[model samples]
Target chain A: MRGLFAARPLLLWPAGCALLVASVAVAITIGPAGISVGEVAAVTVSRLGGADSGLSAIREGIVWDLRLPRTLLAAVCGAGLALCGVVMQSLLRNPLADPFVLGVSSGASTGAVLVVVLGVGGGALSLSTGAFLGAACSFALVLGLGHLSGGTTDRVVLSGVATMQLFSALTSLVVMSSADPEQTRGVLFWLLGSLSGASWPDVWPCLLVLLLALPACLGRAPALDALVFGQDAAGSLGIHVARTRLALLGVTALMTAALVSVVGAIGFVGLVLPHAARAIVGPGHRRLLPVSALAGAIFLVWADTVARTVLDPQELPVGVVTSLIGVPAFVHILYRGRRTA
Target chain B: MSLRAEDVSWSVGGRMIVAGVSLEPAPGQTVGLLGPNGSGKSTLLRLLAGVRRTSSGVVRLDGAPLEEIGRKGAARRIAVVEQEATPQVDLTVGDVVRLGRIPHRRAWAPLSSADEAAVEAALGHTGLTDQAEQSWHTLSGGERQRAHIARALAQEPRELLLDEPTNHLDVRHQLELLDLITRLPVTTVIALHDLNLASMFCDHLVVLREGRVVAAGPPERVVTPRLVSEVYGVRAVVSPDGPGGRPYVRFLPPTGEAR
Candidate 1:
């Protein structure tokens, strides 16, 4: 890995691309029905204009309508969150910062919960819209607080923590006051996060947002790198530090809101995946962002698959599975960081 | 490149730190700012570097108002190495030096060949080539200071501003670092507390007392016994060094009346 990073990064790009393809194939194959590898490939090929096979319509529906969309959503959400985490960590100069650290996830959850429980504008809008709005509001609050407290790292973290707690309390209130038992279940499931409702329609928006934001994040990689040195030094380098940070936060928030609306609050993927990627590759964001994204996508897809298959006929929440895996890994990384420091 | 500050004054909280201070550093000349601790030497360096805006004066680079040039443009012209910079992450020596190229890079572009060459040159100039791959935390105090210098050097700047570059360096490394600064082909302004080192390397001297310039001239003209005694409140003997004509100051034990 060291030599791979030391040499031309163009080499690693191809390997990561190959891994992404393989991971997607594996994800599409491993599910509750236990389709054969050949059948999986045949079904996939047939769907993509290959010759017709013995696969039934049910298998086709599962592969095309359910598994494919869910896998794609996982990949896109994973990539987006990981990229968001990388940028946030660098911008804040704090290793612990993730998309949720700014209370974006809580904001998203509140929006989602309101829609699920209270109903929005007489069903005029869905939970996704509320999630976006909540995410935007929380992001704006964090930015405002950061400015108020001199835009320092401590200020950002404090604001994020405060906003997170406030929104979380509100979310809990909404969930607790629900009279219907099913409504509580819906809110609880959404909080735990899943791709169970993922469909083709949900895939396009996430794909679009991820595609647009990823390149922009990559373009600002040098500026992000400069930020690791500190704001004053970055300012001296003519980085327009505040403006760049605001723009990045806005874009990341938008991506997070979109993903959270789809999968609910999938934690740890954003917080831990970037560190894993950084440990493998160096802290250079240009390579770090994409690799982290790919790794994150691969991780979530497999985690989601395990959540589905862990107890057949009853799926666990994907967020629960990811947290179970991510927390230990995150702690291990922290331990290593402590040793190194 | 001449840096001129006119009637520059700065106050923090409610106390004035630098008041009505004016000075100039000519192109390709090395000027020393000397003062006791808390005499505003560091503040003066900060003002000259345009890191801080003065409350009531103008600082010009090459006769143009510093604000006229944008931050990045000013950065290209003036590079500052502060007294203490301890980054949290464990960046390699090469990584730290590459940061100096930030102002020159476009938003998306990778480090160009020219940029890489400049980094290499800086590392070579600072004699840190062997330590390029080493983590910054592993370096000695003097090595870390040199790494900071290499970072500033990679900017390829026109004027170098240093605030006590030798603060933590040993005597040998201090002399070596000052020697390297003196040999650079650029205007240099440094805030220093070591009178002998300043007198040895600086072409011009500006002595400060209580946020004001007490004396400004060549070392020979500025480092007199009475001048040192009066400004520093210490009895000192001053003598000509050699035919090379630099004044060398020898301190006498402070008498009770000296203060």
Candidate 2:
């Protein structure tokens, strides 16, 4: 998608859609199972009330129940994380800002640990609910601290860093003190992020959240453009600076919380994808947001495919896979930027 | 009158930055605000531009109170260029200029024909047609200021406010920028440091000292050596040999002490 039809911006969107579809289709075919694209399409059509797919129960279950949900979740999380990253980076005017930079992921981990190891929710609350609650609390804390520190962009980032450190420490202390070795391993696996537990229930809520958040962010693209100049300049340009900042920051936080609760904090997708997308589409938020979302979707689909299948019997963490690929790609982007500059 | 500030005062942390200042610039008049460092020139301009609310008194735009107008409505009428507003993102010159059309555009709509035409006219007016596709990071300081002015011009504003717009420019670029500003039909209120340049370009001059208007009139009457000594604590000679009989100020060295 980087060089293909890039000269003609009109064809970029259609090409992006096709690339994303192709990525999902191809990614679904890569697992331990020997399901082909036709079988996968037949199982999907059969689920949608088409004719029966000529496949046994085991193969159908693997396609319908297992691989489809995981792959779709990967795409959804990828798009959502990248969207949140674009919003955060633009709103805060900080290039280093990411979805989890504001401590949402750390808070989610703490919440999951509390529910899983300490049994704080008394068996009624699921892990995702606990994580969501924790993420919200962390975001609220960051906002409060930022407000106390004069509500400037740098102050917000400083507060986010402080909140992240606090929540991370709390999560570590709780897991270390109370959990057994088995519980510790389980918490660690979720902390490092994996898509192995992706189910249909986890997929839809995230997709719904992404669907709601994408349009909402798109509507504020012009406001984000105004914000590239400082707050006074934006105010002079008719942007309600405080209101636009709050709305965008809130959308990013909610989307980040939803995705983190579902996928256990997939790293690098939020931080790196926006830069890659910006390189493709330039800094205009209208093109940058959608391009980032698509690029992220394609990227994570492939990353998750490699994560689950690289070691064959043992699954490496998706976060590990992302960093392994993200670092070299990040270096390449920096090198190119240097040459261009 | 296009823009009027009557007894406007702004204070921060119990310190008055602009105290009881009144300014009224007629339509298409270029008013220069002259002051030493921290004499509230920037604050006065901000208040007049509706970028900051006055602590006391009123600012009226076209006989309507500025606070009554909505942000978008005010922005459509007034565009401000501050001293420091460099964007962090790597944007093209065209992208920076297109930001001026935000007020005229709706949230979900694409650029209208009017917006494009205005942008093109602004780029043409600033002589930046060839540099529109250039990266903003590669632009020189003067070109950056011209781009900023072009962005403001794209708003099609009736009133323009600038704070030390030529602070970082060379002499030729400074004259070119101020020349461009004075030729615009919009009523402009600019804060400037150079007395001779201010006198040469500004139709009227308002000198500020300690947040108060020390002198206000045509540049020839206001740019005297006595006013310079009183307001800026410096000795200067004002001669009427400048362009168009505007006063030219030449500073004289102190005879006794460095203080």
Best candidate according to TM-score: 2
CAPRI grade, predicted model 2: medium
Q: Count of backbone clashes for each model?
A: 0, 0
Each model's C-alpha lDDT? 0.85, 0.91
DockQ, in order, for the candidates? 0.50, 0.76
Chain B alone, model 1: TM-score? 0.95
How close is chain A of candidate 2 to the true chain A, as a TM-score? 0.97
Model 2 RMSD, rounded to 1 decimal: 1.8
List model 1 lDDT by residue over A1-341, tens digit each.
Answer: 23556456887788877888778778888866766667767887887899886778998888888888888888888889898889888988887888888888899888877887888657876888888788888878887988888888879989999999999999889888873788888777877888887998899999999999998898888788777668766766667777788888888888988888778888889889988887777777777888899888888888888888888888888999999999898888878766457
Error of 1 at A305 (Å): 1.5
- TM-score of the candidate numbered 2? 0.97
Error of 2 at A4 (Å): 7.5
The ten-residue window of minimal lDDT in model 1 chain A covers: A1-10
